[model samples]
Target: MNPVVYTVDLEVRWRDLDAFNHANNASYLGYIEEARVRWFKSLSADWAGETAAPIMAAVQVNYRRPVNWPETVRVELFAERVGNKSLTLGHRILSACDGDVLYCDGHTVLVWVDRGGQSVPLPDAVKAACAG
Candidate 1:
């Protein structure tokens, strides 16, 4: 277990709520995505355009508790393993106020892709940043 390298905060929005007044199941995936994006931006030299941006090959999420609107959501992202072409990032969503965990999750298997979308080995910089 390594310290999370990326932390992103998301404020719950009205649109994020479901009929039950809690964050919808689908919205949880968006929250997870925020953390991953933050992680990539930090680890990659040019995530927005120049360098390769990793793509998700798979995702697994387990919702533990419902989140109501107006709550500040905090997400932490970290990697479990760094392979030649892919890595598994660990994700956690929690309430910023009480620290109640809303979801405990595993990552999307991410592989580096070139501008042409061909799979490539993670760059040395990415490998160093993701190494745990």
Candidate 2:
């Protein structure tokens, strides 16, 4: 079954540009981070350290095209793999004005951890949410 995707729209800020006048590569990660946070919030997941939280374990991004300011981008997040203690979320950033234009694509691995920072089992609710 195809996993359900969570999406968020973000406007490219002028500050996100580099001297080259395109969105900086580092800024792409920030966009992904925002989308992830929004996705977690949508799930009502306790990600803010109430007890256990998900932490970034790894990230991989591929730049397909440059994004400029005065543009809106759509970020989509889907569960790629849900594991015992970690999950890989696949993401794509595209022009909100034209979904056909993909600006960046990537996946991030997040591990559930306790306050002590040791890996722990993912909550059932989180697993269910990732299922779709």
Candidate 3:
């Protein structure tokens, strides 16, 4: 099955800019987080339930180009790897107006954990969702 790709469009707010007048590096992560959350919600599963939740284990981001204000950025996410206890999500940030203009790319690793913070196998529903 083809992996599901999730996309979200976000406006570059003025507050997201830094001294260079472009979006701050931290802002890019925030954008990715928003898109990731939205995607998780779309799955319609209790991925963040009290009994078990997915926690970020690692994150890697590569900034390709600066993003200016008054622009809309499209954040795309897809499952890169779905393991027994962990999932790696690949992401790309591109100009919504000009899709060819890529701003950033990255991946985040999420591990399922129980209430005691011990790693657990991912829920079948989550795996099915990732499988698209």
Choose 1 or 3, whichever is better by lDDT: 3
Tens-place lDDT per residue, model 2, 53-92, is 8899999999999998889999998889989999899999
Residue pairs with clashing backbones, model 3: none
Better of 1 and 2 by lDDT: 2
- Kindly list the per-residue Cα lDDT of model 1 for residues 29-129, writing each as its tens digit: 89988777766677665754565667889888877888887888898877777888887787888887767555556566788888789877877766777
- For model 1, what is the C-alpha lDDT against the true structure? 0.78
What is the C-alpha local distance difference test score of each model? 0.78, 0.88, 0.90
For each candidate in turn, the TM-score is 0.86, 0.93, 0.93
Q: Which ranges in model 2 have alpha carbons more than 4 Å from their true place?
A: 1-4
What shift in Å separates residue 36 of candidate 1 from its native position after superposition?
1.5
Candidate 1 to truth, TM: 0.86
* Residue 131 C-alpha lDDT in model 3: 77
For candidate 3, write residues 1-132 as lDDT tens digits.
Answer: 234479999999999999989999999999999998888777765868879888999999999999998899999988899999999999999999999999999899999999999999988877887877
